[model samples]
Target: MINRILVVCTGNICRSPTAAHLLREALLGCDIAIGSAGLGALIGQPIDGAALATLECHGHRPQLHRARQLTAELAQEADLILTMEQGQVQGVIQRIPEVRGKIFLLGKWQGELEIPDPYRQGPEAFEHSYGLIERAVASWAGRLLLRR
Candidate 1:
């Protein structure tokens, strides 16, 4: 029943987009629609350089990704909304209370791990965040694919 998924973070340039791309690949051809947005997005901006480099290092071509702000309509359209941290879960609820039931931590299966932001940081920080996002995406992919 998870046909639509939205990944969320503070800025769309990093964690959320990374998770979305990885999830899209993990759930390839599964009829799921994956997207990402940010609570305070640098709207229309490209992914952060460090984050982009990290993704490219993993063979993912996310060059076309652009940052987008989270909106009520987007949240409403998603069947599942995954956030990078617990605060983000509450943030989504504060903006769109109706989405409360569908919002959850992206690392729900990894002991509720919270993926950190690597914006303005060095490659090491971006690499660490990417690692966490990868693990969370793998865990969610299994559960989501099973629902389809």
Candidate 2:
């Protein structure tokens, strides 16, 4: 019944966008729609170059993604809201109390791991973030696909 998912991070340029792209690829052939947003986004900005490179290096094609701030409307539309860190769960819920039950850590199933922000850190940080995002996306995809 969960048809739409929103991935969130501190900024949309790095972690969230990367996860959204990977999740979209992993969930191919399924009916779900995936999107990414940031709690403190630099709206209208493109995905960080390093993040894009990391995703491409991992065999996933990066989209022409632009940063968007997390909005109440988006939160209302998403059946599930996955955040990169625990603090984000609080941030989203504080903004949209109706979504309390639906919001969760992106790595909740992966032992509640928190995906770190890799913006401006360098390619290595981006690479590490990508690896974690890939694993989290794969885990969520497997479970979501089973529901179909």
Lowest-scoring 10 consecutive residues by lDDT in candidate 2? Answer: 54-63
Q: Relative to the true structure, how large is the alpha-carbon lDDT of every model?
A: 0.92, 0.90
Candidates' RMSD to native: 0.8, 0.8
Query: How well is each residue in 47-75 modelled by candidate 2, as lDDT tens digits?
Result: 99888888778777777999999999999
- What is candidate 1's lDDT per residue for 1-148, written digit by digit as tens? 8889999999899899899999999999998999999999999999888888999999999748889999999999999999999999999999999999999999999999898888898999999999999999999998877777
Q: What pairs collide in candidate 1?
A: none
In candidate 2, stretches whose alpha carbon ends up further than 4 angstroms from where it belongs are none
| TM-score against native, each model | 0.97, 0.97
Cα displacement (angstroms), candidate 1, residue 86, comes to 0.6
Q: What is the Å distance of residue 98 in model 1 from its true position?
A: 0.6
User: What RMSD value applies to candidate 2?
Assistant: 0.8
Ten-residue stretch with the least lDDT total in model 1: 139-148
